[model samples]
Target chain A: MTVMSRNDLLLFLGFTVVVLAMPIWLHPFGAAYPDLLQRFMIYGIFAVGFNILFGLTGYLSFGHAAFFGVGSYAAVWSFKLLSLDAIPAMIFAIVISGLFALIIGYVSLRRSGIYFSILTLAFAQMSYNLAYSVLTPITNGETGLQLTLNDPRYLDRAMFEAAPGQPVPTLLGQSLGGFAGFYFCAGFLILAFFIAQRITSSPFGMMLKGIKSNQTRMNYTGFNTKPYTLAAFVISGMYAGLAGALLAVTDPLAGAERMQWTASGEVVLMTILGGAGTLVGPVIGAWLIKYFENIFSAINENILHRFFDFLPDGVDNVLVAISSKFVGEGWFLTLGLVFVLIVVFLPGGIMEGVRRIAHLFDRSRRSPTKPGKATPHPQPAE
Target chain B: MFEVIFLQFLNGLDKGAAYALIALGLTLVFGTLGVVNFAHGALFMLGAFCAVMFRQLLTLETVTLDPEKLSPWGAPLEIREPLVQAWFGDFGAVLVNYSVPASIIITIPIMLLVGIALERGIIKHFYKRPHAEQILVTFGLAIVAQEVIKSFFGPNPIPQPMPTDLRGAADIGAFLGMQANVITYPIWRLIYFLFSFVIIGGVFAFLQFTTFGMVVRAGMADRETVGLLGINIDRRFTIMFGLAAVVAGLAGVMYTPLLPPNYHIGMDFLVLSFVVVVVGGMGSLPGAVAAGFLLGILQSFASMTQVKALIPGIDQIIIYLVAVVILLVLPRGLFGRRGVMEA
Candidate 1:
């Protein structure tokens, strides 16, 4: 086997360190709490997988939340049927959601573009609607599936004495809760990043990129392109499932709402906002949004009042009144404005902005004679 | 059984009319301008809010402090009078009742201006951009529009009651020479159905019988050739977008009584209307109208107790199921043209 390239080795090490140090580094932003921290990792994993399909293969599936929801349900079901072990639950989540993704990906890949999007959307909505109503027997309906006191839990019951109180998932007696769970998810996030990077650098990843840039040209060159696209879809769907499993692992509950189209759209926004098709861009995007949701949204009218008290009374009131609409309950309004600004001004998202600034700095700091060395680092799809 | 089926069919047509109206405007934009408008539903919402605002205007009340009278708690008495009713007397009372329908006059100009402003401000710049960029920008615009409305209306649904005279059900069976009162349906719902037809017919007539529409149709068929002929087709497409917004707005105005208007109503309808457009065939006007009624009727029927007993929550996903099946089997939708909405 070929040795890992020097740049790839450096990127892997850098990404792992950043993820491992999230709890420490995010302290000043007031987002260092374990639950929120776990969410950042989980959604980071989700957005990265989504970038594989949307950013890499360029197939916009609007129903990835279906797999995510399926993963959660499978995990919870495993907890109820087998044991309170994270392994079995995650395994169940991945395999079951993988099967679901395979089936959905096969059918959806039959048609391309917006039609593919519509088909996936239809399938996911069907899953959500059925899970909410008719499939109540399995999903437990609107209340969502949760660990029950009288669950069989054959493995745990047989292997060891059952613990009392609200049971939590464990890794061979070590509880996967709070910071432990965050680390568990962080490990998976690093693994997911590694897999994504390797895929991007592989020949198969190049084939997927080929389809994205020009499917017709690829087809003219005699590539079927179906298997590659389908593989990417299922891989991304499995990633979504893994993220969903992590959600269940942390919280031990799964609701049909997780599979809603809006949830799927959230991942899309993260990818686009971060920089689709880039290695670290989606992770950054996910962290930024989660930080906004947790930290920025905490700024209520009282905080705004205190912050603006230094100005003239009239000016202070006016500023607070305007700023109030972009925070707290109005955070979504700000989210909307951000979306507009990002799409209009930064089509390549935050990563593009970063690239441009970096390019300018590189140009200024170094001599202009080495022009080839300063070729702007380009995203695969772009 | 016949009466039940007939009633469900009418319900379907009522729903179908709404679907048709919204999808019509969407398809018009897609067909002529080749832009996927995620904000079309917002236009529908704006129209509904127009009626709400107009009613609020007419029902404006003035408060007076009555010094001559005092409450039991010793506070001054207060008197409230609706300004319009006080000014116009009985005529104003009738006018307030009919305000929902009367607001159509204002909804037109307001929606037209909104439509033109949006097209000119945002969509015009995105003509040559990728479909993903178009969808994202418009989706963002939709959120902005929804947020603006929520800011003004406070996110709760504002119910607009129909004219008091149209509150009761009509004896449609008797009108059809069948047994009296056997097939009763709501009067306002029937009016909405008819009003939808009037609007649809008006849009069709406008497009089919006018010189301007001919040019617009020509532009839709071949933009380059028409542009080569020195006819400014871009201006016509801009007006077409405005015209689409007007159609969607009028649909929303007439629909207020059936379902109350909320800030989120547009989003709720957004996906369903997109499904309708896709099912009808992308960029096909007649197909959109036809598919709207088809899906509407099918949806109502799927909700029947018998149907539900057979297929369990089929009613919840019948539209999506049909779309999936149709797309898999037909691919181009019910009225697809070559190279439209395809990858």
Candidate 2:
């Protein structure tokens, strides 16, 4: 077995420290609250997994939310049937989501580009429609899949007695909620990040990137690219499923809305906005978007008024009126504008913006005689 | 059972008309510029709002004091009258009554302008980018457009009723020499279907017979070659985009009376229409129209009580299911050309 490199070890340790300290670092933004923090970690895992396919292989599966939703459903079902322990539920979620992804990925990988995207979208929408309507016996329809008091818990009945209040999912006997839930999600997120890092740096990752660049060229070279792309798709799908299961672990219910195209779009946006090919970029992007969703939407007219109170009366009123449109109910408008601006100006997303700033500072500090060598960054899939 | 099936078939035609119109515009943009316009549905929503705007404009009120009448609070009562009705009397009343149909006249020019402005302003910049970027930017634009409409009209569906003359159902059975009440269809829906045919036919005829459309078709086939012939193909492409937008707008304008227009109506139709476009074969006009109606009929049939009894919720996903099956069997779709968007 090859020994771990010093850089990889450092990166892993740094990632672990940063994620574990999220509650502290996020304190200033007021998004450090447990529920929101857990969401950030979960979605980060989702975006990172999504990057494995979209960033590396250039296959955009618009139906990943199906896997995510399926995972959630599976986790909830596991809890209903088994003990309240999250270990079984999480395993069930990942395995089921993987199976679903394998089937979907196998079929969808037949086409390339927009056709592939549309096919996945169609399948996901089918799943969502069925889950919402005819699959109500399992999914419980619009109200979502929730644990019932009389659920046949073959494992739980033998291990534990019924509690007075609704039971929450636990790790061993420790309930997965509050800070405990955040840490649990954070732990999985770290593991997911490590797995994604290994995939991105491996020979398989290079093969996927080759496919992204030119599949015809790869095929001409006698390389069967289909299995490589399919493998990437399934791996990413499992990542989505893991994230979905984590969502259920933190909160014990699953809604069909999780499988909607918009949710799928959200992960796509996260991956792109962070920087698709780069490892840390998606996690950053996920945190940024989730932070905005939580913080921006919470800013009502009163909050705006409070911020604008120091301004002159007329100026404050005008500013408040203008700023109000980009917050509260208008957060989506802001989100849309952000998406357009990011795609237009910073095609490489926030990471590119950071790189440019760093380059500027680096150039200013270094000798003027040396022209900075341009690094060849991989262009995002066409 | 026969009557039920026949009614659904008619219902399917009406639904098919909408799908056909939207997909037609989508194909036009894709075929010409090679850019996917996700905002096409928003243009349809905007067209619906044009009718709503016209109604609001015609019903603009003026307050006049009535000296003969007094309020219960002892203030002189003011009467509110629509300015158009006061000015043109019966003609104005008829205009207001038929505002939805009347809006088509205004909708065309406005939608054309909207289309041209969008192409010139935003879409033109994206022509050279990747399809993914095009999709992302356009998706963002669609959201913005929908939100703008939502801010103005709120999130609720705005019910636009048909003209009183067009409100009643037509007796199809009587016309067919069957029982009088055996099969009936709504008057507006029939009008809508015929209107869609005219629009579809008109678009095809324009493409087939007009010099401008001929140039555009040639350009679609070989853009660089056509450009070498000294034609201003770029400008023509812009105009084509506008034309496509107008087509979509007209579809929406007429559809207001059928399904009440909501801000998210564009999004609701966006996915379905894209499926229709893909099913018909991207960049194929006749394919889009044929697939639209075919899927529409299939969807309506799936919704049949007997069919639903056999397979519940099939109607909701029939289009998607068919799309998946078709794509798996035929990757380029039923009529899609090989090598087009394959990469």
Candidate 3:
């Protein structure tokens, strides 16, 4: 495979620089407020990792949250036992989560297709349930694992001395509730994005795509497909772990809800919505959905009544009733509709949509080309 | 210990009945149509709603009884001729004071129509799609179904009381003299258990004895071959889907008296039923039944205080835990037909 093009490299660098500068850029408009952008990026990182498995392998895992939750739990545990250095905590988190994924993947990957999906889902639910009860000491039961005053962080514990009777201690000098947590999460997301991008362009990624397209051909061609798939699965798990660690780092807690199967399904939705096979698609998808969730959920009837004041009272009431079904408790309805539309109309996702637009412009530019001569379109960089 | 074991065993059987019924419908659809009916749970909820509607028919209410010519009690009780008179007039009027059996007679046709409409309206469009897309759409449909039910049922469990004759508990332990309170199983649950057995038996017998059943079985095994032999496979498959829906609905209907029916009731059971179907080996009928009972028993055993003392929270995950172990050990499931899941 050829190296990435100079233009693409520039674009990647440009994107990374912008992401690094997001907090400052988003400050004025309060876009960075509520840590919303950071969440988009963190979930984007999680979705990108998830896409590597589902999008590449066509084996939809419905239990990725198990890894995510494991990562969070591991990181929280690290903070409780080891020093509060983010590096060590992150490393321990990813390693533990990857190890858990390795075992789960081994058993689950034995069955392919929907069976695999269900197995992962069941495992995730089992883990979530176990965490809520049997693993209460570690998971802290329904209350979840948080940084307590009792946690001995040796080196930087002084930074997090909560006032007496203030309950749980904050991480470093910041609660999971502020700008520092957002930046910390966004930084990891950028790194994860670059790694995911590299992996997709690598030979290993091609093998996974090959496995998706035709496992029989790969088998007959002398490749032991299990190790390749398992490797991909482990890498994906590590990414999930990193995302989870970042979530805990920002939020300073790990709850059983993090491991629920619905969380796993959300990742699948994010990956697909963004454009599964495309590197940037999952990020965009994650951002789009998270945006709707945080923004749309707040648009209540009072807001609607104020906005549509020009309409007659009766008509406005009807409109509000209709619109409410597409938002709020009915958010899934809108999400499901969008999912169906994308699946039916845009099978390749938003990236495909982008490519089509580019192709259209390219065609118009080549309208005056000489007969029997092909107007050049850029070759796909390896 | 014996008493505990016996009670747990009965508990397993109760839960097993629900699992087996849901699995049976799923298996029927999978076996015959080559489509996984993911909305089976919705159909089950619809059945419970049917039971609720049936029970509402016989409920007698006194509206302060026109007391113009009353004695010392001051009010004469008078029942309103329910609003059913404005709608079905004759049919609705007849149903106002009828017994549950009469109401059930009315419900079967309504449930059947609902089953057919659901299959033809939404599920038909998904038959040719990939399993993921099918799952998504059905998942979407299930959400819509549940939401619609919530709108109608007010987002709460609708209590459907059993007929007066079936209200008390049965004392099976008294016959054995183990203890006076050894087995005081609820009468409604027992009736539900018996009802499920009868329906299951009837279904099996119908499939086993009839020519139509033979053709459907043959079609299930090899649709192309059946089609080549001039059978209308699509029509039969559609019928089978409808039949599966009805079966699910009937199970839900009978199960309502045991537990109150709710909008989200279907989803609570869907995940477990899917596991049962998988553990039973995809499309295997007997496997679904056996796995359903096995998982049910394991779940009950896990929920026991003794088991909880050992594992802390075995009850919450016992079914899934058992499913994972079973899948790992027997990938094709306990009674999986060879080559069914060769891929």
Task: Tell me, by DockQ, which candidate is best.
Answer: 2
Arranged by TM-score with the best first, the candidates are: 1, 2, 3
**Angstrom error at residue B307, model 2:** 0.8
i-RMS values of the candidates, in order? 1.1, 1.0, 2.0
Off by over 4 Å in 3: A1-3, A7-11, A17-32, A155-177, A357-382, B1-3, B50-118, B151-154, B174-181
Query: Which 10 successive residues of model 2 chain B have the least lDDT summed?
Result: B334-343
Residue-wise C-alpha lDDT for candidate 1, range A1-382, written one tens digit per residue = 3567999999999999988998888888778899999999999999999999999988888899999999999999999989999999989999999999999999999998778878898899999999999999999999999997889999999988889988888877889988999999999999999999999988888999999999999999999989999999999999999999999999988999999987887888888899988989898889888889776688998999999988999999999998988888777788878988998889889999999999888877774566556547532563
Question: On TM-score, who's better, 2 or 3?
Answer: 2
Cα displacement (Å) at residue B172, model 3 = 1.9
Better of 2 and 3 by DockQ: 2
Which segments of candidate 1 are over 4 A away from where they belong?
A367-382
Predicted candidate 2 versus true structure: per-residue lDDT over B258-287, tens digit per residue: 999999888888899999999999999998
Candidate 3, residue A363: lDDT: 73
* lDDT by candidate, in order shown: 0.91, 0.91, 0.79
Question: Candidate 1: lDDT of B32?
Answer: 89
